[model samples]
Target: MGWKWGFFTAAMVALSVATWAAGYPWLSERITPPHESTSLAIEAVGAARSAGAGTWAPALLREAESNLRLSLAERRRQEVRVILLRNYADARALLSLTQSQADEATRTARLQRGLAEVEASSSLSSASLAVASAERMSRAIPLDADGRRHLARARSALIEARYHRDNGDPRRAEELSEEALQQAQDAVTRANTLAARYVDEEQIRTWRRWIVETVAASKKTGGAAIVVNKDKHLVTLYLAGRAVRSYRADMGRNKLNDKSRAGDLATPEGRYKIISKKGPNSSRYHRALQLDYPNAADLRRFESARRSGELKNNARPGGLIEIHGEGGRGIDWTDGCVALSNKDMDDLYPRIQLGTPVTIVGGDGSGGVFSRAIQDAVEENRIK
Candidate 1:
């Protein structure tokens, strides 16, 4: 009986050992953490975030993050369970879902970044064209402080956008490019509105009339006349109704408008004559030929403007208008005068005697410099 019992116990022990060997493989799988899948999911989430997934694929990113959190929590729960009962199946499933969502989010973000790069490049090109247009317009009709400021801002934005585009931030580049385009377009619009006056039919007709009458007078008297075209920046000498010589001229600080009153800083537009000539020694500039401003026509206009409330009651029609030297500064700087280089003034001073007609007009009837500049700009815009 004792020998039979010993053999039975030994057999039972051997059977227990066989069972543990077979089940160990299955139990080890369940008890071990899903470390590989969890790590892969964590890496995917990091990649998505780096790809701007939050902005471009918020929904997918959120799901990925949430699933990753749930997976980690499940892993922790499994870790706390009895070792024999521990199962990582739920954690592994959640990790798979997290990886899927994170990878999708990354793909979506990468696609958006590619599209944004293309859009940013196109927008930057458009902004460059607009800035060129504004530059042309500004040359024709010099912009005021506000217009210049807008143009400067546009250029600055364009530069910044290019920097971002070259550095792999296409989304930010696209936004800046859009801003540049708008600002440059605004500058163009303002310039166009201001330049409209250069093409007014009535104004052009008046300028043509003045030029014709001055030439006619010179022809009849066989005397010299001066014609100043503000838009052309030209001072033309006419001898007996024929143009003999021309020189470049600059005008007032605000040269666009006719002189209205004191401190207006605009060149006067009308027929006048040299009332006085100051030589190099006495003149503030190298030489000066004074004109009789506030002539009958000028007075009439001034009085009318005052009546219309365009000028103050005490305002005086400023005088001392002249054709002066010390010019060629390449800008409008005078109070209200036509300026020439010292050499041009010296050549003209001797020939122009007192009472020589000086006809100043806003433009020369024919499309002047401003018009040609605008036309070129339009052609360029069309081509681009």
Candidate 2:
């Protein structure tokens, strides 16, 4: 279609042979020189037509049609040549369009192939993430045994998700992926809690269990005392007004609003005892400390909400919130939990006993400015 010239010579030869076969033998024998010239011209015209150059064929058919007209001996040949040339032009145009369509089809095929590859690659990347998450959890044991079992089950589900995808079951694959994402989110969240953390690398932790046993063995006068200063953001040990150790910490994502009801933005204020401690996190956060967030006050508040339709009737009770260490130190950031450095949590863990008193200043009744904000918000809600 694109100006190929090879069809000309073949066209000429074919026409000459047809003329000889049609009884036009020699120029000198039966016809006048002019008549012979005209017959020879007819032969040339046939060849030109066969060559498929027609003026009407866009650029492609234009020349062949013009050439065929020149070979015509009679004026009527103009009409015949025009008709033949138009047909030739139409045929060539069709051929050109067919080629274009073929090329486009090839391109579309390649595009589909590329998208299929992306889908495959995304799947592989997702699998690698699952393996890494599992491996990360395996390196550390959760502070609580029950937490450990849940984490194990989550990892197992992730494996099944991957398996179903590889085996070509998309329905199962989608469901498993959804569950894995949820579990991973929850596991990382819970890991931040101090109620369930582990000893940091090469850090010496408190031998609280040993201390408590020794104290219990000796039958000491007072129970263990835990204190937190919301104003100073300091957690203190009260062995009689003596500061044992202080660690830098981050507050919460929300301001002084103590988390009163479930999903409250405020961190709860007031006196509360540590019920459990969770550990060295397997999460991106360096370490975590779990606090008993939904204490008796929280439950009562939540219960009222449930009855009044202020809370979701089917919501699962979230009881454990925490103080923990994140990827880096400095800056308060959490849903409603305290935060510390990974190294700090490791140092503080052993010193904290199971029933230590935790007094958050901005959190408890004697809280810093933060606690007042929580109190104000709570009061405003009550007024409304």
Q: Write the per-residue lDDT of candidate 2 for residues 298-382, one digit (tens) a residue.
A: 6887788788897788854465566666622454456666667677777777776776666554422343333332233234331
Q: TM-score, each model? A: 0.80, 0.34
Candidate 1 per-residue lDDT over residues 1-384, each given as its tens digit = 999999999999999999989998887889999989999999999999999999888999999999999999999999998988899989999999999999999999888877888899999998888887777677767788887987999999999999999998887898998888888877766665566667677988988999999999999999999999988888999999999999898898876778888788989999999999999888999999999997999999999999999889999998999999998787888998999999999989998999999999989657666666556555655222
Q: In model 2, where do residues sit more than 4 Å from their true spots?
A: 1-224, 281-284, 308-317, 363-384
**Residue 108 displacement in candidate 2 (angstroms):** 80
**Model 1 C-alpha RMSD to native:** 4.5
In lDDT terms, which candidate is top? 1
Worst 10 residues of 1 by lDDT: 375-384
Give the number of colliding residue pairs in candidate 2. Answer: 41
